[model samples]
Target: MGQPIFYGSVHVLFYRNDEVLLLKRKNTGFMDGMWSVVAGRIDGAEEVVSAAIREAREEAGVDIDPSGIDVVGVMHRKNTSSEWIDFYLKVKSWKGDIVNKEPHKCEELRWFPLGDLPETVIPYVKSALARNHDRIWFESFGW
Candidate 1:
């Protein structure tokens, strides 16, 4: 077999009262123009938590203390392919405003309430939020 690709992405769901930070991806790669939380691939030889913190800073220009962010669960997404995703939930905290650093990868940034989320949100993120109500931690959730 040829070289295989195994992706490890970390996502953190941040809630401010009712609304949450979401990014509208630009017309680029997968799920372009869709809304999703802070996400980025885990680098080789790097810790998973560091990836989440780095993604938050790089994607949204936010500084998150790695230890403060709680790992809600790990969802093994298998939509078109299989990949491991580490899910974190930061209920009440975070500094700096949400800014779109990667213009090529994102177009707009907005905060939507939990009760009234946009239809463009990625299916996996939607499922993550809904299922998070039960405090489900460390389990596989489909995309």
Candidate 2:
């Protein structure tokens, strides 16, 4: 074999007080009708932090400073068809009003209490959020 390849993506947990922002995916073919955070695939040659900031802006219409975000956890996820490495970043503060920037791909954006997330959240996303960020740095899903 030459090498192994995995898709890389970033997830942003925008926190406000006791809540975290979630967007209901709509037309996205992968996980339509499920709730997820601001997220996207890393562009070629882009730094992970830069990808996080770009995703936040593209999905939620928010601007996040690199210094204001924390890489809370990472997940190595694999299913029947593909594998992905996902970085979960936490942001307690950001600029601009949060809106559904991609109305065609996302249905609506809402905030849910960190302690009580909705049942519709994406599986791996829910797993990442349930982790004790201070203690765990990585997790694996779907074997």
Q: What's each prediction's TM-score?
A: 0.84, 0.93
Q: Native-vs-model 1 lDDT?
A: 0.75
lDDT of 1 by residue, 82-140 (tens): 55655556534667877888887888878898899999899878777766544656656
Model 1 backbone overlap count: 1
Name the best candidate (by TM-score). 2
**In model 1, which regions exceed 4 Å deviation?**
1-5, 133-143
Which residue pairs does candidate 1 place in steric collision?
73-138
* All models, RMSD in angstroms: 2.8, 1.5
Q: Give per-residue lDDT, candidate 2, residue 109.
A: 96
Query: 18-37 in candidate 2: lDDT tens per residue?
Result: 78889999877889999998
